[model samples]
Target chain A: MIVEVRGLKKVYGSKTGVTAVDGIDLNVADGAIYGLLGPNGAGKTTTISICTTRVLPTAGQVRIAGVDVVAEAPHARQYIGVVPQYNTLDRACTISENIFFHCLFFGFSRPAAKARTAELLEQFHLTERAEAYPAQLSGGLAQRVQIARAISHRPRVLFLDEPSAGLDPQSRIAMWDAVKGLRHQGITVVMTTHYMEEADELCDRVAIIDHGKILVEDTPAALKQSVGAQKVYELHLRDQPGRPELCARLSRIEGVSKAEQTGDGVRVLAHGADGLLSDVVSAASPFGLKDMTITEASLETVFIQLTGRDLRE
Target chain B: MYARAFAGLFLRDLYVLRRELFPFAIRVCMNPLLFLFVFTYVLPHMSGGAAMNPTAKMAGSGGGFGTVLLPGLMAVAIMFSGIAAVALPLAQEFGITREIDDRVMCPLPVWAVAAEKIVFSAMQSVIAACIVFPLAYYIPSVPVQAHVNSWPFLIVVLLLASLVAGALGLTIGTAVKPQQIGLIFGVVVVPITFLGCVYYPWAALKPIPWLQFGVLVNPIVYMSEGLRAGLTPSAHMPDWLILAMLCFFLVFLGWRGIKGFYRRVLG
Candidate 1:
């Protein structure tokens, strides 16, 4: 494991303390994209903060590359890079200067710092903005600069807190590509985000956390499988009449585990759609099935099934 | 490795300072210039001339009010620059935005970050004093000769006074919140400047026994008196006492400030 966290707990305030991270344990493999998937205020940032040695945990042990984070934070910090949730770039300095200073802070010599900064700026396609300060760049460009700065020291482990938070779809995809490129370089990536699709698309393994506890931790496919449904069948109806009746009849179909009214139709969850799709269509025929579609279960459904709430909520 | 990290951090601050040198120089010189003009020139000229000034009457053979006020103005410049260097940046860094997160998360130990701020501010304080020294001497209405009888003692006083100012800045910077920054100027800075023996000698306050003892707690008093002792020996505090007070303030403020800084950063 490149990163290990055991029994981690953090409490804010002393007398009337609010527990931010409550006894969470995690082990991340080298070169894997691990994600903490949760809504805002779910302690993902606190957990990442503790693991990255930015914030102290009230009780627990966190080891980065086998070194105890609290006992030897400076050593731990040397091997890890963090791109915080907010843009913490030194707006007064140019992009190149920011990356150069970051490398220097990590004990890189002048020549090495300069070379690494140049390489990162080019790699992130921020070469043109090298002379521009953070304020002058677009949001995506600024985020790229922040990432370039974080990795200028060539840290083995990288922690990105909500790397795509406030970005448009195109910018988000670009950021994801940058992160994926890092994983190819053998860097262990740990990121926190509430976007379920982001977790599904990017993470090799994800932990679903809520109320300071991990509800489940597994690969995105396995997490969806844990929902105990193989296929989701949506039956769009021409009218809302007999919707409850159609849902009740659809639930009784062979291999169908659950059915509920969704929009102007009934959505049915089944163990498998090989033989169940025809049965679902037949059951919906009496209710004037306008259209029908069947798809595999997704992380969003799995998250809602496990937490009883939307990830965005 | 630690040495290199410290150098990098300090050099980064220096780079930023260099980039903003013009505005920074203006901020450092504006107050001293105004004080030098008004107290040394305007006040003396307004009340007839330097010949009728009370400070001239007190210093029978020496220059006049300008000579006495020159060192005090240097002290003021050092204090203002030193405090502004750390206090303003720290306030914004620790505000709702939390821009200092990147700095504290460096591979170096937490206290190193605080040390960098202190040392940087100390360097700026010394620079401010150097710039103000000549202006304080030449800009006054009356002819002033700030006889530096002992260059070594003068250097020592300037260095120690700047260090004390830096330490004091660190304390205020880390201790106060962003919204409370205005209070730092109104409640702390203004009071210290007025009671710091900038306009008159500490010995002259002997007649007001209560104030003489009360103003002793102000760190600027020692800096002003130390400058007086080094620059113009005719009217000044004891050399040993000035050095002792500055050293005390340096160690005490540095200790408390570093502790507070560590707490804020680690939390």
Candidate 2:
């Protein structure tokens, strides 16, 4: 395991305190991309902070490459690189200088730092803006520079907190591509994101977290497969809901796997909706169906199934 | 390895300062330049000349006001440089950008990061002292002979006073809010400089007994008086007491500053 977290917990205050992180245990394999998928304020940032040795845990420990983070944080820092949720690039220095100085801080020789900085700038497609100050760059460009600088020292583990948080679609894809390229260098990556697609697209394994605890952990495929459906049809009725017979009648359809009553609706989960949408619509029409929506069973659906709420909430 | 990290941070600071050398020169020289130009040169050259000036009478010598101000202005330079180099920038970093995060990620202990700030600020303080020394010496109308009694003693005071200035800057930088940084000039800088034995010698404060004792707690008192003992023919506090107080302020402020820095950066 490149990153080992054991029974980790962080409580903000005393006995009746708010627990930011509750008993999280994870073992990430070398060279694997691990994602902590959660909503806002779900302890994802605190977990990464603990593993990166920025925050000391109230209980338990994190070991990065066999070194306990708490006992020797300085040593642990040698193996970990971090791109926090916000840009931390030195405002005083240019892009090239930021990366060069970072390498120098990690004991790189001047020439070595120069070479590494140049290589990172080229790798991240930031050579054109090498002399630009952080404030001069757009949000996407600045984020790219931050990523390049974070890994300039060649840390084995990189923690990116919300790497795609304010980026445009194009920049987010570029960021994902840059992260994927790191896997070729045998670097273990641990990232936190609320975007389900980002986690599904980038992670080798994804852990769904809520209210300071991991509710489930699996490959995106397995998680989706566990949902046992490909299409989700939500039927909203103007009339009374919680009608068990409506759900029972809908589940009897050919492609429908299961049906459950919601507040003013009945959700039908189906493996394939082909030739089954008409049957579902007709069955739900008797309850005075006001609206109907369809979506594929994705990580979002998996999260919704586990937590019974929208991830965005 | 720790040395490498420290050197890296130092060289980075040096590089940044190198680019801002002009502004740095202006920042360190402005206060003493105006003070010397107005008080020592303009005021003395006006109507009644030296006779009518109460400050000249207070010093009790015809060409002594400039002589007294030489070391006193140098002390001000050092203190202001410390605040400018360390405190002001630190407030911006801690509050606005959180740029200090990258430096803290270095494979060095957290305290070393704070130490690096003080060390870098101390160098600027030393440079500011050097800059102000020459200006204070030559700006007076009477060409007051700013003689150095002991070069070795002068150098020692310069280094100690610089370190104490940096420590003081660190303490202020970490203790205050970034939005409230302007308050430092009114609350910290003005009060300390006025009560810091800059305009007059500590010996002259003997008539105001309570104030003389009260100003003892201010670190700039020792800085101004120490430079007085080292650089001029003016009366100064004893050598042992000056050295002891400088060291005391350095340790006390350094401790408080480092603790504040640690808390601000870490969880």
Candidate 3:
């Protein structure tokens, strides 16, 4: 494992302390992309903070490349790069200077630092804004520069905290591509985000965390499979008087595992799609079913099924 | 390896300082220049003495007030520049934005960050003292002849004074919060300047023995008196006492400042 966390716990405040993380164990393989998926204040950031040595764990053993993080933080720091949730680029210096200085902090020679800075800027498509101060860059560009700085020293493990939190779709795609490129370079990546689609697209393995604990950890495909369904059937009902009554009746049908009223229709999850579709239609016939469509189960559906709450909430 | 990291951090600060060198020079010179113009030039000339002997009537047993005020102004320059060097940057670094994570997460140990701030502030303090010295020596209305009797002693005193100022800056920078920065100036900096014996010699405060004893606790007092002993030997504090107190403050403040820095960064 490139990263290992065992029995991790964190508590804030003294008199009425809040447990931010509670006994979470995680193992990330070398060169794998790991995602931590959770809602706001769900201990995702706290887990990454402890792993990166930014926050001391209350009770845990975290090892990066087999080195204990707490006991040998300075040594462990050399192998890890962290792109924080906030913009931590040095505003006083230009983008290139920011990256160059970070390289120097890792004891790179001046010529070597300059070369690495150039390579990172080029890779991130930030070479054009190399001389620009942080204040002059747009949010997307600033985030790129921050990532560039973090990786300037070429750390073995890169930890990104919400790397695409406030980005447009295009910028978020570009960020994902950049992260994928890092995985190709044999760098292990650990990231946290509330975007379920992002985790599905980028992560090889993901852990859904909430209330300071990991609710589930598996591949996105396996997680979706664990929802006990291969496909979801949506039944759009006409605004009839008995629509709610129809929904309750459809939920109790044989082979139909769960059924709930969505904004525009009733969504039904079932293990076998062989007879479930006809079953849903027959149950909804008297209520004046308008349309019915079947689609593959997704990570979003799996997350909602596991947590019993919307991922955004 | 640690040395290289330290140099990188220090040089980064130096680059920023270099970019703002002009404005920094103006800030360092403004107060000392104003104080010198009024206390050594305007007041003495308006009191009716001739150009060379303008302040003879106001002269005490040692010399005119200009002689006494010169070293104090230099001390003020060093203290202000030193404190500003660390305090302003630290306030921004530890503020709500907390833009210091890059440096904090560097491979170097945490204490090196605090040490770098002190070293950089001390360097700026030395520079400020040098700038204030000539202004104090030549700007007075009356001829102020500061006899430098011992160059070695003068060098030692100035070096110790700079370290003391740097140590104090570290303490103030780490202790004060961003919103309460203005309060530091009002409650800490202003009072330290006024009670630091900046306008008079330490011995001249003998008549007010209570105030004299009280002001001794101020680190700036020792700095001012040390400069007095170097620049105007006739009116100064005891050499041993000045050196001893500054040395004690250097150790005490450096220890406390590093501890505070660790708490703020780690927490």
| TM-score of every model versus the real structure | 0.92, 0.97, 0.92
Lowest summed lDDT over 10 consecutive residues: which window, candidate 2 chain B? B51-60
True contacts kept of each: 0.64, 0.78, 0.66
Between the candidate structures 2 and 3, which one is better when assessed by lDDT?
A: 2
Q: Per-residue lDDT of A1-313 in model 3, one digit per residue for the tens?
A: 9999999999987778899999899999999999999899999999998888888888989999998888988778888999999898888899999999899888999999999999998999988999999999888888888878887888889999999988888889888898999977889999999998999999999999989999899998899879887778878877656767776887788777778777666778887746767777888877778998887777778877877677877
lDDT of each: 0.86, 0.90, 0.85
Ranking by DockQ: 2, 3, 1
Give per-model CA RMSD. 3.1, 1.7, 3.3
Off by over 4 Å in 1: A232-250, A259-267, A271-296, B51-60
- Tens-digit lDDT track of model 1 for A169-209: 89999999999999778988999999988999999999999
| Candidates' chain B TM-scores in the order shown | 0.95, 0.96, 0.93
- Tens-place lDDT per residue, model 1, B140-164, is 7777766777889889889889988
What C-alpha lDDT, on a 0 to 100 scale, does residue A127 get in candidate 1?
Answer: 87
Ranking by lDDT: 2, 1, 3
